[model samples]
Target: MSEAPVPTGLFSGITRLDHVGIACRDLDASIEFYRSTYGFEVAHEEVNEEQGVREAMLRVNGTDDGGATWLQLLEPTRPDSPVAKFLERHGEGVHHLAFGTSDVAASAAEVGGRGVRVLGDGPRPGTAGSSIVFLHPKDCGGVLTELVQSAR
Candidate 1:
């Protein structure tokens, strides 16, 4: 009989909550709401074509030593995209949580073996050159999960 390959530790450790994705019908409107009501400062913003999302990161003052971070907005580019579908059904709310990983490939493989459905077949290039993969919500108790391996 063939031996099962040893599973490796992919995540050096879950570093932190990289970001919390929020599905929104209107990215601009949701951003404004966070700014006006919560005073969150926009740290960065960008558009991802492959995933078809326009997103922004917000810095929440006093959450960290000085300020912590949270993802304020993400709007799907098309109605057919996953984020768009989520908003249509759920009407805007927490979409997913991203965790910083050390080795995305190994983490994905391990999770996949446990019957968790992964979005990408393998690690794909993501924002900021990080290798990333998405775990389908069906296996994760209705929460989309992203494992991101830092480029550095």
Candidate 2:
């Protein structure tokens, strides 16, 4: 029989905050806001149809010194999509925070054991062809959290 997966203790296995996802009513406005307020630089941009949203990655300035980490802006393609719902409810703000982990499935399982609810039972394909999993907001202190395995 295959051995059961082991949980890493309290996300300690995670090394850093990969990115922070923000659901925006207006992608251009949010991008401008981040630029004007924080001077972040755009690193990547793509439209993900499977996720039904368009996204952009903005590298946080001085992140090596503990400044703002990478920021992701998500604009929904449909009004019924999750990002749209989030905007309707929260009014353009941070949606989730992604953590960089070596083994996302193991860390997710560990967090699940602690009564945290993960969106998926296991890792799944995400934007840019990366593996990822989302944790329920209730378990993350009201913040939706995504665990992402590096593309490397």
Candidate 3:
């Protein structure tokens, strides 16, 4: 019997679990809760009008290193925003999981070539000036996934 060929190039550039996005009603409250309860510190915060979210990246553990994983809290900027729609359906919880990649465009192309549906036409602007592309939840085992390429 012939052995099946191994698939290549799918997520091969992914380096680490970059962040976990959490959808919330209030950004400040969520940030405060994480600070007081888990002692997490906000590393960055910004409003992404294109994505329709006001988000904060909370550094897990300490800030002494650049490799710490982040918890991204996302609050919708408008009622018609994607985050708001997610909140309406799921009532505030984990939204997506992001993986760090060296090249978002290459990763996206490889994944898309393998029949997995990527969300947009191409990589979009992400937090911290990174480039990002989202994979459909249905194609990603029912969990939304994002590929992030940090700004150089």
Flag clash pairs in model 1: none
Model 1 alpha-carbon drift over 4 Å, by segment: 1-12, 61-69
Q: How many residue pairs clash (N, CA or C atoms closer than 3 angstroms) in each of the candidate models, in the order given?
A: 0, 0, 0
lDDT of 3 by residue, 86-123 (tens): 99998999999998888899988888898889997899
Assess every candidate by TM-score: 0.78, 0.81, 0.88
- Tens digit of per-residue lDDT, candidate 1, span 62-83: 3222224467488999878888
Cα deviation of 90, candidate 2, in Å: 1.4
Ranking by TM-score: 3, 2, 1
lDDT (Cα) of model 1: 0.76
Q: Which candidate number would show the highest lDDT if scored against the true structure?
A: 3
Q: In model 3, which regions exceed 4 Å deviation? A: 1-11, 61-66
Clashing pairs in 3: none
Model 3, residue 116: distance off in Å is 0.7
Flag regions of model 2 displaced more than 4 Å.
1-12, 61-68
lDDT of each: 0.76, 0.79, 0.88
- Which should have the higher lDDT, number 1 or number 2? 2
- Error at 99, model 2, angstroms: 1.3
Weakest 10 consecutive residues, lDDT, candidate 3?
60-69
